[model samples]
Target: MSHSLQHEPAQGVTPTLRLRPDTGKPNVRLRKQSDGAYRRHPDEIKEDCLSQPSEQIKLDISVADYRVVSKRDSEDTVQRMRESMKDIPRSKRAAEVKCEIIQIIVMPQLVDMRYLQTATDDVIERAVEAHFVYSSIYLIPGLSLAASMCAAFHRDWSWNARGVYYRHYYSPHWITGDHTLWIPTIDHDMFDHPQERPRRERAQRLLRHALDNKRWTKSEYAWEADAWSDVFGQIRDDPALAADKRECYMNMAEVYPVSATLTGKSEMAKRIPDASIGLATFHPQHYQNAIASYELDSERLQALTLHRKTSLISDPRLGESDLVYPFLVYEAKGWSGDPRDARLQACAAGATYLDMLDALARHPGPSGKVEGAYQFAGSRSAQVFALTSFGSHWHIMVGYRRPRLKREHAGHPGMSKTVYLYQRVWSGLISDERKAWELLSLIDQIHEWGVTTFRDYVIRHLRSWHKFGRMVWKGDAERMRAVLGKDAATSGQFIIFSLPSWADGFGTDFKAELRQKSGRLMLKRLIDEQAGEPSITCVQGSCRARGYKCFSPEDFVRHCSSVHDNHSGESGRSVVKEVFDQAASDMKETLQELRANCYEIGPEADTSCAEQAWTMVHDNTCIESPTRYN
Candidate 1:
């Protein structure tokens, strides 16, 4: 935020903290209503209309989904969370922290949307410009976090009430700052859009529910202990079974706290929750299927590996066969000794989860439901709200290719992908007993909620990656066109908008600068603008809005008037032939990496760090019909 606060020398001194123009005491005017009700003064409404920044922000978690980010960003994000809420407590003083920050606040955007949808879907619902306010306060010991987030959202519910439909509507009791924002958290048009929400939500909800029944604990999963024991005993007793993979699994489960959830924690005598962690199998039936689909599958890559705390080298293995099935990573060294590596490991697991979605989309699961596979290995009936996880990094990417080259698999082929960093922790560095206890609790949360959230995003991102951009509530599709220009496309009904060009490498690549010398800003002006614009990657046999041959705004205007202007609405929302751009690597997600490593003091020095710098405002119109070309 400080970086943003710092103005160019030409702008004189650094800018002062400014309240959102749409909000603030100056912008608010109260008036009595004829029926004894109070409402915003006309001027207040005008101020909001004239000055309201974008009411929505797009959280690009794909970076966290795909690549590693600066561990420093974690602290920055957390601090930013505090700053944005510095004035939120109008009458109360926040609790203080001693030694370390046990009272951490997660940003509104970073809070997994899965929990939001789960808690709020029934009460609030998803839609365009529906408007939502969500925030989560995490316990170093997270038992209290969920309740706190729900509370925060409810508290902030009134922020956007006046001048919006929500103003006169009775606030649902269940919907509150005490819970995830229940009112629609999207734009007005998204809420008004008839069909987009369901199509996107189907996959999102599928991924969310996939893991509901998958979590296991010592008592819950104890039945599987014998099977694990048998496998371990066989690996230990039989010389042939005593291969490196077997040793790694045995050591990880019994000796090291790799399967910390399953084995019970060694640091603490008794593990609360008594959760049993499971490892992914290298040769599972699905593993073979994933490999089979690969253009070039390496037999040796089937086994997933983790850095061994006991040694510097990483150990490779499929988890003990058929243990309670959650993902596990054990470093004899400790959890996340290398926070980056640990994050990468988590990313690898998340990436694999996407492939699972792709496969499920492409083929039927044990339950024969296309939405998801059966939860348990042998279950004949499939459940809707459950996901199974095994740890394996995959090379199978589902992305866009020219229609001529597009092939049907178990999933959509026209979807390109991007990855970014989300939440991370330098787990091995946790020293305090309180911190350790908190760490175990967090691990359980990750298994039950975290991974599934990532999967849900994978479903959402997969949609966006396939050029179905973020869910466009109401008329945001037109807004998307204004910002993305030729780089964008919309789904049928204009219910969804996608940066299909993103599939062809038009995303903000945060990590690109690592290889870009003096930073991305170092580029020449024209080159920078060109680089920022969508490249001509998609074959425009259909969506002339893609502007395949146009090189200037004039050209685009002429082409639109000639071919797209009149036919622009849903009927004009064309499915262009997708052309895969292998060289297009558009993966720039800017969320934080690891929190434990952020020890510096400045913006984060105070517990309630106050900065609202991580927001972007775009898409003002409640678009209906195709926005005509000027």
Candidate 2:
């Protein structure tokens, strides 16, 4: 038998079309007229509708345009324009270079303090203060003297001695020919004491012995002398060492001398120059004695003095003034043969040189002088010394630059360039080098630590640290979170997979229980939706086959069924049938009551009698009926 359904696109909307099975081909056909209306055949009814194309359409267009110009012509035009513009003048260029130098020197210090305060702890402030003290006591004087001595010694020393000094000092003085002056005191008592040998005495003895043996040839001396002179000239010219003269002299006693001079009363009366009278009171007895011996010594030493054309006076004041110029020259002479002495001399020179530089760099221009013309302002010079002892490296900052900027510029745009100064030990200090790099890398890692900008030095290192952390810790989420944060963990490209250990056991066999419970619940819902209706096969095979025989009291007595069961087959089919019959009867009564309630309460009232009937039947139903034998 075939059924036909009405097809109405306007009201019901037509279902999707399907091929007619009866026709035995992929063809759709309409059913015959039924109830005076044409309808679609059951086989032709569609489960899904065909989709139609959309009315809107998109269009695309490609466009082309061209322009022509001669390469040679354009080049000619550009060349002409370039030629018309003037190049920056040499003076302006020099000024810019100077300005840049000043900026580099000063700016970092001024800005770095605030950055340090924000990035780190109070250590920065303490470090700066300590640096100030170091500058005052060591760096300024050290570099100034070193510079002066380098210049003087390079000029005065033999070629061999100059080379030795250069090798010992690692001087940049070679590049900038400025000599600094320095005079170091040799304590008389220190040399005289018998308990312990003095290093200075040992060095002096070694040098004197070397010189006596003519160990250094004139050719070697000549070669070294030229090199030394060039280097010393650079040191002298260095702007930073301009103010270190006083400190260098004050520290060294040998640089100053005391002397006596005398004259006849008549000649002295005429020669009593204002300057001479000032010194007369200080040297009256010595001058008188010198006058008595002058004739004999003057004639004896006349040829030697004439050839040299120089005066040697043992006056402290004169020595102090004159010795300042030759301190570096003497130091170079001392450094030629002894490694220990060379090192000490270099250190002392470096300190004094740096001190002078600092003082000059910090010097406010000549009291109240103000001019628009640019001048070379001395900058801070720091010296880092590296000494290797017992296969270990030690580093010390032996010099510093003094702060020198106008109060207005102290907080100005150019202050950083003026105030910034530092010295680094590039090599020969392994542990310190490592630590410096590590700190720089740490700064890079944070990028903006609180408010401080990380330097390039830090950036280079931080990337490595990040890679290391990732490699070592691998998939540790907690650790990754602690180091980098939730965002970083997710941002990384790789995924890390992990599973819990299989040691935990469920108290019950949950898998089996869940399957069983789910199956039962599904079956119950299905049955309820069907309103207790049994399948046609089940009703015919199970219920009607047994019929009234199972329900008979005789069958129950014969079977010797238990009190819980009525006579059925061995599985008590009679009890199950009886329950089904009772459920049907109850359903009928519920429907009758619902109808009566509806009539009384008005037809609009929803009694929900069908729902109640299903609930009652479901609640009372058992999984299995009682067996007749049991």
Give residue 118's lDDT in candidate 2 (0 to 100). 40
Scored against the true structure, residue 483 in model 2 reaches a CA lDDT of 21
What number of clashing residue pairs does each candidate have, in the order they appear?
66, 83
TM-score of candidate 2 on Cα atoms, chains taken together: 0.15
lDDT string for model 1 (46-144, tens) is 222222124211122222321233245456778987786687664453543224433334333322233433443233122201222122211011111
User: What is candidate 2's lDDT per residue for 115-212, written digit by digit as tens?
Assistant: 34243324443343232222111111111122222232221121111111112122232212222211112234534356424333333433343333
Off by over 4 Å in 2: 1-223, 229-250, 253-336, 363-630
RMSD of 2: 50.9
Give the Å error, residue 21, model 1. 15
TM-score of each prediction? 0.19, 0.15
Steric clash count of candidate 2: 83
Model 1 segments beyond 4 Å from truth? 1-326, 330-338, 365-421, 424-429, 444-630
lDDT of each: 0.24, 0.26
